[model samples]
Each structure stands twice: as C-alpha cells, then as structure tokens.
Target: MRKVVKYLIVLVVFFMIPICILAHPGRLDANGCHTCRTNCAQYGLQDGQYHCHNGNSSSSSNSSSSNNSYNNVTTRKTTTTRKTTTTTKKQVYGCMDSSAINYNVDATNKDGSCQYEKTETKTEDINYDTKIKGNLKEGNKTVIEEGQKGQKEVTIKSVVDEDGNEISSEVVSEKIIKDPVDEVVEYEEEMSDSEALTILIIYVLNIILVMFYSKKNKNSKLIINYVRRIKIRIIKYIIYIIYFVYVIPVFIDVILVIIDFVKRKLKK
Candidate 1:
C-alpha cells in the first residue's frame, strides 16, 4: 500500500511540473530581441548609448594702418570647445536557462549575450512508467493492488525538467479491475442411496435416543453413547452434502486427481 502511494505521487509530480515552471515570474527580460527590434530611446541593441555636444565658439576682428590712414585700432579673438561619450551592452537567452535548474550543460550562447525571454508551452505525448495494475502473469507489473485484484488500466503523465525529478503529474485515464477469486470448496466422497438413507435414519434415531435417555436416566455412560452416535451421524451427513454440492462441479479437485492418474499411467 505504501509503495502504491509513492507511484501516484511520482505521476502527479510529472503532470504539475510544467505549471510550476510557468507560474513563477520569468528571469528578468531586460534583454529584448534587439537585432530586428530597433533600439528604443532609453536603450539600443546594436549601438549602446552615444552622446556628442559642443560648448560654444566666438570670433571678432579689427585692423589699423601704420601711416595713420585709419584712426581706429583693431583687435582679434577666437574660442572652441566640444564634448563626446559612448557605451555598449549585450544580453543572451534561450535553451540554457540561466536561472533554471541544471540538467544539460552542453547548450551555449550563439553571439555574445543575446538576451531572450522564456515563453513555455506544454507538449502532450506518451511517457514510460512500469507501474501498472493487473494480474502480473509472467511479465505483467502492477502499481496498486490492495483494494481489489484486477487488471487496472491507467493513463498517467508527469512533467519534469531535463533531469527526471518529479515536478507535477496527472491521470490521463484509469480503469479499476477486480481479480476473480477461486472459492474454497470441500469435496466429500459420494455415497449410494442406501448409504444416504442409513445415515438419515441414524440421525433421527440418535436425536430421539438422546432426548429420551436424558429424560429417564441421569447416567453418564448412556449420555456418552448418545454423543458418540451423534458424532457418527454428523460425519456421514457431511460426506453426502460435500460430495453432491461442492467437489464434483468445481472441477479443480477432479483435475488434480486426473493429473495424478495420468502420471501413474505414464510411469507404467
């Protein structure tokens, strides 16, 4: 019984495992599919943050001749400034779940960290389990067998990670079967009609004798005789009933006898 409960637990774990994986908030999906997905204002895929700026620039010019042709004096001034900055970032996602449990270690990130979001969907198909209920004739195996004996057909599925740890499970279908029990039969030797009548008459006489003797005599010897007669009559009645009602029709006992007879003949 304890073992049966364990199998059910394993099966249930298989089915429910997918749900558990889906239920949790997935690993942070900061890394969007940026290749085709053009870079947004806040972030860019191909090129990271880029900035360029110029502070300010000014110029002035004036001139005066040595011969004093021009009365006013001239002056010149010039200024230049500039600013620039750049940044790059990458992400990866897909087969190898960074956050998921370890199962397969062979997967890799194709190009740098190509950030990806996990979108899981369930797949339905057959799974192998040896535990099944039924008459394990030779090769047959069973999962649960205590409540009743039978050939129970069951459909079970479980969800697990790459490794075979039980996560969640469900029953696709089930059938309860009852094993047929052979009735225990007692066989007695058949008797002739004369033998039957003889016992019947003896039973009646014993009853009468016991009652009448008890009424007349308080003697121990007579009581013992009455009991002995009753024992004999009971043994005969049992033989008649067992032979007619049980042993003959059941056939198992008769088969055993036939087999023994065949064995004897073969030896001869």
Candidate 2:
C-alpha cells in the first residue's frame, strides 16, 4: 500500500509540472519566450529560432539455416529545420495625447506636439453728466438720452513652440463692434410760477402771525415795543417788495408761457 501511494504521488507531480508549464509558457523568461518542460519546443512559435525533435527506433531480425537465404535492406533518414529572424525597432517621438489636433498614431513617446485656437478681448467704459437748460424745479431728473454699452473686438495672433507652448502673442486687428451711447439726464433746479406763488402766500401768513404775537406780548416797556414793531414791519415790507419786483415777474412770465402752450395744444 505504501509503494502504491508513492507511485501515485510521483505520477501526479510529474503530470502537474507539464500542465503548469503549458498553462504559463511566457512566465519563464522576461526578455523572450522559453521552452516547455517536455523539451519539445512547447506548442507555439517563439520570437527567435526554435527547433523540436521526435524520433522512433524499431528493429526486426529473422534467420533460417536450411535454405541459406540472405536479405538486406537500407533506410534513409529525414530531418526538418525551421528558422526565424526578429528585427530591432527604433523609438518614435510625437504627440501622445489622443485629444490633441496633431496626435500621431505611431508615436512611442510624447513629444508635446499640439495646437489650439487663440483669442483676445478689450473693453472701455463711457460716462454721462446731467444738465439743466430751461426753467424747472430743483432736485428733479429726467432721461433725455438712453444709455448703452460698447465693445471692441481684437484678432489675437500667437506663435507656439514645437512643445505646444505659447511663445508670444500679438493683436493683429481691432475694431469697435458697438459705440457706447452716453447717458444724458436733464435736471431742473429753478421753481415754476405756481410754486413761487405758494411760497409767497406761506411767507405772508407767517409774517401776519408774527405781528399778532408781537402786539399781544407788548410789555410794560412801551418804547421798546414800538421800535420792535417798526423793525419787523419794515423788514417784512422790504422782503415782500423784493419778491414782487423780481420773483413775481418771473412767475407771471412762466404762467403766460404755460397758458400759451395749453391754448396751442387745444387748438391742435
């Protein structure tokens, strides 16, 4: 039983080595293919020259003394030979990136050969100011001209090196696509006729109230009260005269102009 187990183990080991060699034939040598464990040149062809041999030996002999017969035969040997040659390759250099425009298909190393489109842009700003040309109230604004943005286009020219790096850039041509329109805001600082009239009325009423208070608060000092009353009356009278002469005339003129404009509009 021991001998039979040993024999079975030997058979299994013997068969397993050949099976492993057949399964991984290229794992033997890193630089080139290797022969199998059977020494029969494995199964497939190798890179360099390879040879395999299989031979069979057989012999037959017969002798008969009674008849004194003699026989002879000659055999010729046959052999087959196979040869292979491998050529050494050179290293190729070119763009290795697949997304580049100048990608080379037969490139073995990256040479950084690539190209791309270039562009540039420039811009400027426009400002505006407010102005008042006619009679109008203060702190008022109106848009006389609308505002718009402008842009300038430039054709950028650049030179790239053999390594796909930008060496220099220049503006070849430039032109304005749209001219900026400056904003114009019309402002009004002067009051109209109706506003001046209302202010004048308010001032008159305020002065009358002051006079009534002064008269009611006339104290034991009668002379001082009289002088104060005179000063107040004189100041108010002068202010009223100034308004009537300068401010009131302007108001009247504005009213006349507005009435004329309304009549013309009605006629139309």
Query: Model 2, 140-242: lDDT tens per residue?
Result: 5887877776767767877665555786789888888777777667675645557666765665565566556646764624645455577577775765575
TM-score of 2: 0.27
Q: Write the per-residue lDDT of candidate 1 for residues 8-99, one digit (tens) a residue.
A: 99999998997664332213223211111223222211122111111111123322122222122122222347666666544543346565
Which parts of model 1 have CA positions greater than 4 angstroms off? 1-148, 175-268
TM-score of 1: 0.19
Best by TM-score: 2
The estimated TM-scores of all candidates read 0.19, 0.27
